[model samples]
Target chain A: MKLWHSFLKEMKLSARGFYFYVEILVAVIILVMILFVVPENFRSVEDEYLFYDWPEGVFEEFVLPTLMEDDLDGKIESVEVEGDDILYPAQLIESEGTRYYIFESEEAVLRLTDLDRPKIGAIIRMDEQSQPYYEYYLQGYETQRLRNVYSIFHILDFDLMEAEFESQEVRSLTDGYLELSDRENIVPAMLTFNGSMMGVFIIAAYIFLDKQSGIIKAYAITASSVWQYLMSKVLVVLVSTILSTVIIVVPIMRLQPNYGILFVLLLASGLFSSTLGLVVASFYRNMMQAFGILYFLMIGLMLPAIAYFTPSWNPAWVQWIPTYPLIQAFKETILVNGDIGYVAWVSLGFFIASGILFVFANARYKKTLVS
Target chain B: MIKVSNLYHSYNKDEHYAVKDVSFEVEEGEIFGFLGPSGAGKSTTQNIMTGLLQLQKGNVTVAGYDVKTISNKMFNQIGMSFEESNVYSKLSAKENLEFYRKLFDVETRDPMELLRLVGLHDKADIRAGEFSKGMKHRLTFARSMINNPTLWFLDEPTTGLDPAIASEIKGIIREQNKKGVTIFLTTHNMYIADELCDRVAFIVDGELLLIDSPRNLKLQYGDKLVEVEYIKEGETIKESFSTIQKEDLDKLQEVIGKYEIQTMHTKEATLEEIFIKVTGRELV
Candidate 1:
C-alpha cells in the first residue's frame, strides 16, 4: 500500500514537471515518422544481381554449378557475342522467372549495364591460393540486411566448394526478413532504443532533481524502505515506457506481435534501465557531477543499435551488451517465426540483472543518501 | 526519549572526527537544544541520534530503538525538519504534506490541519517552488508534525524567519512540547534556545562544554550587577554597580538618595554571553 501511494505521488510529481506530456509528444513524433516518413520497402524491384567474372571461365566453373545444384534451375537462353576475341559474350541466364546477366569482365559489364536497372554487382575473382572470392558492388538504396543476405549467400557457396561438400540447401534460423517489411523491421530498434531504454535517462534526471531539492533527505527519515522508494520510481519509469511502446507498436504492428510477450520484455528492459540509473545516480550528488557516467552508459546502451540495423556485423563485445539481446527480443515478438525460447532467455537475463542492480542501488542509497 | 553515549563521527572515516566523544540525553516531553556555531558538530550529533548518520563508535537509542539497528517502527515515531527546506518543488503545500503523511504506518494528522497550524492554510494549493524561503521552511516544519511524532528532530527551525513568524514557530514548538512531545532542537540561535529549550547544551569544536537549564547556567556563570541612570547636577549620569561588592552597593545607594533616579534595572547575562563564556567561542 505504501508503494502504491509513493507511485501515485511520483506520477503526480512527474506530471507536474511536464515529463508525462513530453513523453506523449515524443511518442507522437516517433509514430508519425515511422508510419508516414519511412518507406515500406527500401529495396526496389530492380535491385537484382549482376554476376561479373574476371578470368574467362570463373563463372562457368565456380558459380554456374553452384546455382544449378541449389535447384536454382539456371539456364542460358541466349549469348550475345560482342565480336571481341579475348572477352566472351554476355550470357543471359534465366531461372525462377528472374534473369541474371553474367558478364566476362568488369569493363564489358559496366558498358552493357542498363542505367535504369538498379543492380547489385557480384565480381568473381581468384585469390593467390587458387580459391574463389567475391566482391559485391551495391546500389546506394539497399538496406543493410539485404546487403548482408547477398554476402552470406556468396560466402557460403564458396566455402562449400572448398570443403568439397554437397550441402546446397540454405536453411534459415528464423522465417527470415521476408516476413517483415523495411518499415516494420525498424520498429524493434525504435522500441528498444527510444521506448524501453527511456527509463535510464528519465529516472536519473528524476533522482538528480530530487537530490538537488533535498527530497531524498526528507524521505530518509520516513517509514518507507529504500526498496519501496526505488520500486516506486521504477514503476513510474515503466509506465512511461509502456506508454511510448504502445503508441509506437500498436499502429504499426497491431495484433501481429504478441502483446503479452512484448509488454513482458518491455517491463524487464524498463526495470533494468531504471535500476541501473538508480545505481549510477547514487554515486553522484547531482546531475552535473554525473553527466560523464550518464553519457558513457547511454552511448554504450546505444551501441547495440548499430549491430541491430546491420545484422552481419555481430562483434563479440557488441553482442555482450544488454541492449543487444533486448533489441533481438523485441524483433522476435514482432515477427511471426520468432524464437520464443530466445526471447524467454533474454527476458530472464534482464530480470536477473534488474534484481542484482536493485540490490546494489538499494544498498548505496541507504548508506549514502542522507550524507 | 533520545540518548547518545560516547558518539564519535568521522566524515573521512579517519581520525579527523566531526563529532568526538559526545554524549547527551533528552527526557520525555523535554525540549533539548543543541547549541553550537557553524561546523561545531551539533548537526552531526543530532543526525546520529535520528538515524540519519551512521553511529560510528558509540551507542544511540531513540524511543527505545537502537539507532544502529533502527527499524521502520522507530521512524514512524520520529520526524526530522531539516535545516533547509527539503520538499518536492512541483507539489503543492498540501500535496507535500499529504505525500509525506502517507510514509508513516501510524495514524497521521490531517495535512490541512498541519498546514493551518503553520499558518499556510490559505496557500495550501500553491506550489512549493513558488513559495518564499520562509514559507517553504514553514511548510517543512508543518510536514515534520504530520506523523504526530513523539521524538522530533528540528534543525534550526526559526533560523531565517522574520520576528513574527519566528515567534509563531516558537509558540508551535512550545505547544507541541506541552503535548508531551520530546524535541531534539539543533541550532546556533541562542535566543531561540534560551526561550524555547528546557535545557541547552553548549558545544564547540566537536566537543560539548556544558549542558544545564538556562536559569542554572545564567546563575552559575552570570555576574550580579545593576545599571542605574540618574540626573546629578542637571546632567544625566549612568553607572553600573556590582551587587556582590559592598563598596559599589554603598555608592549605588548614595547616588539613589542624592539625585532623582531616572531608571535602575538588574542586568542579566544572555545565553549568547554565557555560551561564549563557557565555550570561549562566539555563536555565528
Candidate 2:
C-alpha cells in the first residue's frame, strides 16, 4: 500500500519461487534432526587407513606377529627389575629341542621358569610387550596357565621363558587420532564441490521462473535503476544461496551449533555465488540459454575452482580467475579452519567484484529487455 | 507546454528512423490529438514527446525541460497512459491507484473518490488487470491523473470502451483541460478528436500534414452554402445557397414560405471525412 509496504509486497511476490528451496531445506533439516537426536544413525564414515609414528622395528616385531606372520623368537629364561617397572626384563635364549612359547600381560620377568623353547613365535598383545616390575625381585619361566586375558588390541597375552628376551609392562590404550587422519584427503574435494557450486540449483530455478512468468517486461519499467534492481534481485538470490550453503556445509564441518560463523561464511558464499549467477544469466534470453551459458562458464569457474575438486591440483595461474576469490574465501574459512583474517579480505573482494559484475549484468540485461 | 522541432528517431540498434522530421507544438491548455493509422509514427512521436524514446536529431521540450538532457526531472511533471495497460496485475483497482499515488510530489489523491469518478468504485477491490478491457482502460485513465501532472499523454486511451463510457472519458478529458492541463493524445477515432480535442494534428508516415482546431478544420473544408431539396407536384426540385450571406438567408425563408420545403439546412463535412481528404487514408 505504501512505498516500503509495496517494496515488501514485491519481495513477497518475488519470493514465491523460493518455495521449492524451502521444501528442500525443510527436508534436509528434518533428516539432520532425526540423525542428530536419533541413535545409531549409521552414515558409515568411509573406511580409512593411515600411517602413524612408531619406534623402529616395533611395528614389525609386535604388529607382524599378530598378523600370523611366523618368526623365530628367543626364550625368556630369567628376569630382574632393580628399580621400578624396568628393574627386570626377561632374558631370551633359543631352545635346543623343547617346543613351547609364552607371552602374557603383567608377568614379572623373574617368575618365568622351565625355559620352554618358543615354537616359532608367540602372539603377545601390544599392551603386554613391555616388562613389569614389583619390589625389585624378578625371574623368568614358562607358564602353562592360559588365562585368556585380552588386552586393548585383543591379542592373547603370553608369558614365555627365554634367556635373551626382555619383559615389559604395557597397559592397553584405545588407539585414536586427534585429528582425523585422512590418507586419501577427501575433505578438500567435498569443499570444492560445495563452494561455488551451491548456488547452481538456485540459479537454474530463478531463470526458469522468470521465463515461465511474463514478469520480465514489467521489470523493464520499474522506477529503480537497472543496476539497483539487479543488485536487489542478487541480494534476494544470495539469501537463498547463503541459506542453502549453511544447510549443506554446517553439519559437514560438524558445526551445527556454530550459527555465527555459519552465517558469516554463508553470507560470503551467497554474495559470491549469486553474483556469479547474475553474470552468467546476463547472456540468457530465457532459462535454457542461462543453463547453456552456465555450463560453459562453470568450466572457467572449475578451472580455478580447482580448490573444490582438487585443491592440490590448482594451476599456478588460478588466482587470475574471477571465481578464485570466492572459492578461496569459502574454502579458507569454512572448509579449512576459520582462517577469518585471510578469508575476510577475500570475501570483501568477492563482494566488491560481485557488485561490479552486477552493474555490468544490469547494463547487459537492460539491452536484452529492449530486444 | 509540449513542443518538438525536427524530431527524428529510429531503433538505436537498427536501420531507419521510426519518426522522421516530426515537428509540432501543443499549446498549453489544449488537447492536441495525433491521429494516424497503425504503423504510422503516431506512437513514436508520442514516445519522443513523453521522453520515452531518445531523440537523435530533434529537440523535444515538455513543460519547459529538454526531453533528452532533463529526462529524469521531466518524468515527474508528466502523466501517461499508453495504448497498453500498465497497471499492476496483482493489485486491486484501489490498490493500483494507491501504489502510484505516492510517486508524485502532489498530495495523495483519495483512491475511493477517484474510482467513483471513473465508475470503478464498485469494482475497487477487484484486480485492475483482471477487469474487462474497457474497465482497465477507465482505470488506466484514472491512473494517469494520479500525479495531477501538468502535461498528460494518452495513446489510444479509449480503445475498448462502449460508446457511453467513451463519451464519459471525453468529458473527463474536457474537465482536465478546464483544470489547465495540456493533453497530448493519439487516436485513430475521428469522433474522439472531433468531440474532445481543442486542436488536432494529422500525422502520417512521420509527417504532420495538417494542424488546426477541429472546429476550424471542418469549417475550412466544408461547403459554405446550404443545399436544399423539396417535392413539388410529382416533381422534385433543389436549391443551393450560402447561409452566411444576407440575401441567401432571406431566400431560404422565401422558399420555405412559397412551397412545401421537404428539407433545407446547412451542410458541413465531418472530421473523419476531412481527415480522409487531407491524409488520403481512412481513420479506421
Best-matching candidate per TM-score: 1
Docking class of 2: incorrect
Model 1, A87-191: lDDT tens per residue? 446666555544566665676555444342465566667788867677777656878888788767765655667676665567766545347899998999898
Q: How far does residue A97 in candidate 1 sit from its true spot (Å)?
A: 17
As for candidate 2, its interface RMSD to one decimal place is: 4.5
Residue-level lDDT tens digits of model 2 in A1-371:
23344455445545544544563565366446544653442233211111212455774477435433222353234433232423434233323333222222224322332121221223222234453211211122323232222122233244343322465554434332122223112322333334345465455455445534434433333233445445555555555555554554555556512345445655665666666676676565566667667777667666764454565667667877756655555544543334556666765666676667667776676555433
Candidate 1 docking quality: incorrect, acceptable, medium or high:
medium
**When only chain A is evaluated, what TM-score does every model earn?**
0.68, 0.51
Per-residue alpha-carbon lDDT of model 2 for B224-271, expressed as tens digits? 888889776767899898878899889887878777777767888888
